[model samples]
Target: MREHRGVPPILTVVAILVLGLTLSATAPAAVAAPTGKPGDVVRSTEITDRPEARMASAARVFDVTYLSADPRGRLVEVKGSVSLPKKAPGPGGWRILAWNHSTMGLGDSCTITDSLGKDKRGSRDKWLGQWLRDDYVIAATEYQGIGGPGVHAYLDGPVAGKNTLDMVRAARTVVKKYVGTDTSNAFVSFGGSQGGHASMWSNSLAKSYAPELKNAATIAHSVPTGLSDYFAAIRPGFPNVVVPDYVTYFSYVLAGLKVSRPDIDVDSYLTPLGRTVIKNAQRLCYAESGPATKGLTVGQLVSRPLADGPLLPALRQYTRLPTSGYGAPILLQQGYLDVVAFTPLTGQFVSRLRSNGVNVTYRTYPTQLHGLSTAQTLEAVKWANTRTTWPR
Candidate 1:
């Protein structure tokens, strides 16, 4: 196996990183304490660089480490910033607002801009900070690969869930400095695009994965996931959307599949184009993803049915809804104007959840595109405050 480098040694850095910190030493590794659920723990920490000056406006932002319960042992470190107002939300305790960033590291990458702020939009929009400031403790994550080591898991389900869930736990454990509350207070999650998918996975798994969480809220704006649905949607016409970038998603799925089914050959699934995309995806940015997507067509990539191989079966488990509904209330915000995630698909999924007897609140926003919907974003935060007392 070729050495896929980039992941930092998280376990090695935990002790030196958390020293003199508010959190006590990590309870123990791979062993769940009698806290709440299967993978619950007292707390954990990580070493990350200090935030840039722009981040200071938010009460405090810190880099922290957390564990990946995935059998793959992927690194799940992230950078999170939190602002706790004078009063916490629910029961006069602490309430947390965890923003799973679109593509940037957990910090508000949306805030960066040129002089006129012409290109300040997209995933880096700064509205997140302003929107979240007075409400609760806002924590954004960078996921596993952005700052630390190994390739970023991207939209890979288990890997994304691992980082998202761990970051939630780590944020609650560390944010006591700004907002004093037990890890159990009101905890809400929100993200759009890939972020929305992350929120859904986190909310779904919180019951079994991190039972300490009280409320799990998800706001999805044009979630470009569901590999099967995505592959099917972009086929025949939108070649560039599916072919060039479809492989980008496939690579993560391949790596994730490698952990469980080693026999599956990742290279076999890739064409000459697919291999090049994976090798260069790290260096490519938002600007590049657009131009790179040009000229490619979906028909070119769907040469054969992806279901013929093990990858499709693996992806089924990856994109499927959660096994059991969340113990906490769930709020799903979808943008009707979103072309990426598409309104039809999101609507279908929401209807299915309702049929399955899930406790859910669905809000659809018109005029909102494939990014964060203001209605959904505000609702998730307000819901979070009501659910927990962490910020109080």
Candidate 2:
């Protein structure tokens, strides 16, 4: 109207009104998320980047966003990758592996997409490459918050479990869409470190959370358990002895609590110095952040005692792994000398699993350290294959 400088002629005005209504009714709307059920794909974009798409055995790779729920049962979107094998499947269809990743960090830049891309390729993509070569559909979740909504719930077991299982569902959908092949209902949960922790939760939650998908077996290595006990040692000046990456690991827990437990006032639990450290921790990935924690100690970072009282309960909820509720057999691999996941804590976790009558197969490497268990992956995959519940 201002540009026109006067009311248009009646015919012109009528034409303008008609065009406005037509455009309003016909113009494409902005992209909207799919109505999600747990595991339903919200969207999947092909990974065309050379480094990211160059999987040795992948027919196609995608960066997928799918639905999952927080601990509070609220729906949320989680990002993950779906790698379909180039090789044709046997009559049994594609064997599926839900690969839970180890700790990367609470930052988006540390997501599987980033790790699968050119920035940093660790043993993670290499392991997935093996699965792809062996003719498996691999669904590796980056977890709920790494590149999705909200801050990551670092060690939040149930949440990670949901994301991992849901990724399997999304993988099946993608495999069918892109490959025109059916998938075996049976799938295995496999991961190391934080991924191990997540796989354990997926194993326990599968029967209850995703009855439609058959969780054949689960293999976890160097998983964190009995975290409550370790957390109890964190006081203003505690741990009796400071250890490498303790501050880095604990600060990650705090960073996650910023979103997962808003009532906790996570910042209040920190000292002024602690607050500054946590802000950086939330943004930096493991490789970048781990070195920064060199010489940093719990005593220097925190002012409050997390061992007892109000904070203790939340810590237990966030860190403690479930010992029972496992419907399928579990293979737990541990390294006696592993510093990343202390041996004693894993022992306690295994004991609880057995005491609860859970069918658990335990393997320990006396000479192995945390990541050295990679050599045993072939054996672990064999074990999972034997136990896999296949369709008749």
Candidate 3:
């Protein structure tokens, strides 16, 4: 028995020890990968290098789409990505934060990703991304038509809100496979510019649309609420950047309200220049289009006595506000020097929401202009983290 008491079989002991440790380490990684998956996720990275892919990657690098029902109660689709804080708990265990991208419809399919690969600063804009890093799952939507099958409704609140709420459901759907329960987590909404409007409107419409997931806090930066007010403020300066925006507005109104007003002569309503401008405007941000369309004169687009015109009145009717109030804790960041989204209109919308008894907090940035204003993501995170349940 060659002294078998001591090192009888070193190889046997090594194999047993190695197998046990390997199993222990690999098991947890697998479970956590599925359940506690980080929110900074994307469907694929192969498309990331292409020009179009680069753009989408730039805007929302972590592009993850999930299945959720549309407002019509049908199984519709949504495209977006989630950003979870490092060392953060899973969605149900911790807070879930959802973000809405500004303009470019729901899917604008804009080429910005969460990775900040292109611009170095990228879409996560320093202040905005830092605030988003607190303790939440930030999900940004590409809205309808921007990336997917349907046409983007632009400022259509009901449709936009429906899409936004559905995105939460979509995210929860993905999260539940790992966490088991859907309603165990809390959610907050945040966005700026057009996103600001969507954030507020979606907050208002969430109670009725998807009452399960409560809205913790909503932050808006110079939100455009009242179409009437927006028009009133800029009508006098139509020849400036406002005219092309007006054209774009009418185009969106036509597209969103097409079902309600089928009689609209979509082609006749658009001038060759209006059509061209609107076509190009759809791809640009407020800042880009503002300066791009500066050359167009007002009289060329809309005639005098704008009220009775074929397009002006129709546009006015399409963008009018509904009487419903957005019920959510809100933080509004208004840029006093914002020329694109007139400050007065944002104030009026805030007034309307506040008067309706909605929980709201409004802040104004006296010197910041439209392009220069930070997304104000810090306040949104702080406000959202305070909510215990949904609809905070």
Using lDDT, give the best candidate's number.
2
Query: How do the residues 282-317 of candidate 3 rate in per-residue lDDT, one tens digit apiece?
Result: 555545655666656543443233343454455566
TM-score of 1: 0.69
lDDT of each: 0.53, 0.80, 0.55
Worst 10 residues of 1 by lDDT: 107-116
What is candidate 2's CA lDDT for residue 349? 82
Question: What shift in Å separates residue 380 of candidate 1 from its native position after superposition?
Answer: 4.0
Which regions in candidate 1 have their CA more than 4 angstroms from the true location? 1-57, 70-93, 104-127, 130-132, 177-184, 232-263, 298-303, 373-376, 383-392
Tens digits of per-residue lDDT, candidate 2, 152-263, equal 8888888999999999999999878777878988888889999998998998899889998888889899887776777677778754344557777888987776667777
Query: TM-scores of all models?
Result: 0.69, 0.86, 0.69
The C-alpha stretches of model 3 lying farther than 4 A from their native spots are 1-62, 67-75, 90-92, 105-118, 122-125, 178-184, 230-238, 241-262, 280-294, 303-306, 309-324, 371-376, 387-392
- Best of the two (1, 2) by TM-score: 2
Q: Which of candidates 1 and 3 is the stronger one according to lDDT?
A: 3
lDDT of 1 by residue, 20-91 (tens): 353455554453322343223234332222333223224444445444543356333333333433334455
- A best-first ranking of the candidates according to their lDDT comes to 2, 3, 1
RMSD from true fold, candidate 2: 9.5
Q: Alpha carbon lDDT of residue 137, candidate 2?
A: 84
